[model samples]
Target: MESIFHEKQEGSLCAQHCLNNLLQGEYFTPVDLSSIAHQLDEEERMRMAEGGMGSEEYRTFLQVISNALSVWGLELILFNSREYQSLMINPINEKAFICNYKEHWFTIRKLGQQWFNLNSLLTGPELISDTYLALFLAQLQQEGYSIFVIRGNLPECDAEQILGIMKVQQQQRPKLIGEDEAQSSGQGSVLEAGPGVVEGVVDEDEEELRKALALSRQGMEVEDEEADLRRAIQLSMQGKALLGKQP
Candidate 1:
């Protein structure tokens, strides 16, 4: 844990933090991303001038930011890519995932067999259990987040090397930055009850979070079943037609 490199939220630099955290280094800056965006802009304009219809996305910067990631050998594959559905169904080899909800971007990555939530909004890196990974991702998808599988090699860090041989368990979950202050202001009585009482309250909250994840997973499963049933019906109909046409 001591070797883990974490950068708390700073201004609107979540993109920078997300990338640096995934790569396990201070490898990119605003200037670098800006340079990439400029290059993309020039290329887009060139294509437009060449009589090709080019799409310009000014509503959001995600497209430009994703291109910036490519400069570092990082490729963001859509979680819902039809071509990669099998891979996502059982993501054993996945190294990292970047998620976007509206304009906010965050990353979830695996290091030394442990998964961590590297969201800038959190107070620090969150240690996520392997058992909870699929539920967590399914919940995010239900909540309108566009998840992308990060494909490429990530630079190794001290934490990864150390944890490879020794696994660490998280006793407490990471909270959003300023969460304590908000809780203190609104629930002063709860704080006065001591640390044990606080843990109880956190437990109740965690239970609710788990329930939401379970519900999301159930919904996804139901959808998949329905799709399979529809496909079977179509195939049965086609088989019947062929039988009727047989001489």
Candidate 2:
């Protein structure tokens, strides 16, 4: 994974610069901060210039980038601070990451098992140890600072296979139902459902299966929305030259 540092730009465009570096490659084109800024409403752009982007604006920007990248079969996943463990454990090949530290944003890239910090505000890329990164995340959590993990170029996997893996993992762990749901199901004392059979087992199994199906349908709906957004962006880019030459 090649680490692309952010380019120096005016105003509070750190997030934009970090995203541009993250998406620069064959599968995804580099993002232009100026073009994005121009597209924003006057008030939103002014907010960015005055005090940096808020959470909602940053999320919308990420969605735009994600929509563009989806054309080439790439996906971006944003994990909140609560999901730091999942972000650290998952290894997506040749991906870029943007993380927040001390209210400032920075970029990071992973090559094999090693991580490199490519903070444009700094002098150069610095090799970061996994242990150190974990400790830093813990400290951030303790201080109640907002931390985010933006991962690009997720690996493609078969939907069925992914679901199978999820099912297996869920089965291995104990399931916690809400107090009301448990009472209604007449399984109030049950902390977890064992592999063995129990009373009203068929009904319980049917309910769980229905919930899984609903979740699967929701996932398909999201995929459809992403595909539609990708097509719209592709059409918009057709024959419309980008401002300035490609970086």
Supply the TM-score for candidate 2: 0.42
In terms of lDDT, which candidate is strongest?
1
Give per-residue CA lDDT, model 2, range 33-121, as digits (tens): 44543466546633433343355655555555555545546565544434555546643433556554322444565533555555444
Error of 1 at 77 (Å): 0.6
Clashes of 2: 0
**C-alpha-based local distance difference test score of model 1:** 0.59
Give each model a TM-score. 0.65, 0.42
TM-score of 1: 0.65
Give the worst 10-residue stretch by lDDT in candidate 2: 238-247
